[model samples]
Target: MKTIASCVQEIIISSPFLEEGLSREIINFSALAKDLNKPISNMLRKPVKNGAIMMALRRYQQPLNLENSNRLKTTFKALGDITVRSNLSDFTFQNSKTLIRSHSQILEKISANSQIFYAFTRGILESNIIISSSEKESITNAFKNETLIGSKDKLSAISIYLPNGNSEIAGLYYQIFKRLAWENITLYEVVSTTNEFTIVVEDDLVDKAFSVIKRLKD
Candidate 1:
């Protein structure tokens, strides 16, 4: 008979988290065994151990670090006070520091959602502009070509918004993303504008990823 521990191990290795590599930093079987007060060796011996292993693999697949720790606090501070109900947008393919312009409608829609994560000073707009729903549709449709570079298993995307007179700021943002990549946090998508940059990640990693960017502003 297959030992229960062994079975559990088999299941974990089979899961997508291990296969996809989106969050390898957060998941570790041996660490989990220690946490649960079980010996790593014994946990490896159970039948259907594969399932447990996979569960453990996914448990921390979302990157959680000092950045997210602060983001949660800041997000709460900036947008948390609003009464609108909004789900955190799944910007799994967005990068930061690029100017983002929305069509009339998207801005309105975004304004309604309370989970809005960032604060930008719109210097020129006489009034505080919000993302109306129509504007959201126009912007998403406006950007036709999406460019992503890196390995398929680990990819990063950066949105480019090269406008007159803003090259220096763009370079700074690029450098920041590059440094994070050096730390092995692969980026998925980058959305940009002459003055804005939006970074995206797997949904599970959003909070932790947000934390990472928050540090740069501090």
Candidate 2:
């Protein structure tokens, strides 16, 4: 059976901003319950008193970071390396049947150089290619016939090597990203793998972004 606490937890966890507010004790419990009253009542299949939902809100604990804090700290301490690449180009192209062919052509033209930084992230309706600014001309030549959605220049990337198997640990990413968010850093793109997390930001903000990420273990 779904208890009031379960329903409250479900609602809060779905919105990170609300969860953060609750954690910081900045949310007014009664007001929150007022807003959540109908939803919680619908969830419980019965009318729930707003006061009871408020009580549940007060009782709800953040299951994400409290237990995982120490483990996340350890993982941060063991972060392998912080790699920063500059003068990057970000190319976003609308998805198309011919998009993959264009990508293949670009790879064939440039993958020979092991020194350059290159990354490609595909989304449902679009895809992004981040490469050294020097490759801008090559990308243009390859995607000339395709739909160029948007692009940005003077970008930089920060790739943090995570400890092995960090994927299994909940809140690892939240802890890492929360700090950057606090600093008001606008993330252009975020790419990650099993053991690595990379963020793309404007060149001017790279220093502050790097500092925020570096201090996560501190």
Candidate 3:
């Protein structure tokens, strides 16, 4: 059965900013309890006192924050190389039966050039391709018949080398994305592997983006 504390915890986890604010002790507990009163009551199928919600929040935030903070600290300290590749292009295509075939063509064309940067991600509705600007023509030719949803030139990508076992770290991605969003940076495209995190942004803003991520290590 749902209780006040469980409901409050559910609310907190769903809203990441709330978790962060509460973690930092910057959020107003009484005010938060009042705001959450209706939701917790609805979840428990009954009325919940504001003071009871506040007490649950107080009970949960510290240990939760401490655990996450310790993991984050270790992860950042173990962060590997941060490589930035400039002058890239991003292409978004509406997915089609031919999409995978077209992507293969581009890969075959550029496979010989180890210096060229390329990354492709196929989503359910769309397929995104990011490549070195000089290599954009190859993709354009390869995907000529595909439906192009959007494309951006003069983009740059930051490929962050993550430490081992990052996939097991809770809230790891949230913290990285939170820092970038806090800086008001626009992420044009993002792709990742098990231990490699990549973010593509406009060419001009790359330096600022790099600075922001680099500081995460310090």
Candidate 4:
């Protein structure tokens, strides 16, 4: 049989925002108990009273605080280095495979001269590429069969390098993203490798984003 405490922990882990409400004492226990009874009953194979559910929620709140603190420590430690690049342009291409074959030389030229940011979606319906603004002319000439959806210039790229061992830590990216989201900065796109995370945004927001991320290191 599943214990009340275990069931409560499962619920909090699954719905992380619930812990926030519980800890703030903003959640109405009666409604929460009623809503959770069905799932908890399903898990335990027996019905539970509302009072038992409320008690379980209260018991698990302290543990959730400790867990969040440990997660923040791990995430901060994983962030090794941060950098920003500006004056970039983003291009979206349709029918990318055809474009690749038709303009191999031009593509190579752009690749050699610029920091290329490229992603191809499954089924090859669309491909998005970004490069330095100086390579715009070469990229334009390269498209024979591919449709140029649009291009955006004056963009900035923020590169976050993670520690070697902790690069793969869970929630590391989320912590960075959450900080950006909190500041209401719109992201153009995000690209990542095993040890590096990059977010592209408009050039104007670069300083604000950099400051926000710098605080994470403090």
Per-residue accuracy of model 3 over 18-46 as CA lDDT, tens digit each: 87788778989999999999988888888
Query: lDDT per prediction?
Result: 0.40, 0.89, 0.87, 0.74
Pairs in steric clash, model 2: none
TM-score-based ranking, best first?
A: 3, 2, 4, 1
Q: Write model 4 residue lDDT over 53-97, tens digit each, in one string.
A: 878876675443566567667667657778888888888777645
19-74 per-residue lDDT for model 2 (tens digits): 87888888899999999999999998999999999899988987745557777778
Supply candidate 3's per-residue lDDT for 128.
Answer: 87
Which residue pairs clash within candidate 3? none
Give per-model TM-scores: 0.28, 0.74, 0.78, 0.65
Q: How close is candidate 1 to the true structure, as a TM-score?
A: 0.28
Candidate 1 residues lying further than 4 Å off, grouped into runs, are: 1-165
Task: Write candidate 1's Cα lDDT for 1-218 as tens digits.
Answer: 54444443454445444433434465455655444334434544433344454465455333336654554344323321111212222211223223343323345555666644422233342212222232334434532232212112122222223334444322355435644664456555444556445554544455555555545444
Residue 153 in candidate 4, Cα distance off native in Å:
1.7
Better of 1 and 4 by TM-score: 4
Given candidate 2, what's the lDDT at residue 100?
94
Highest lDDT model number:
2
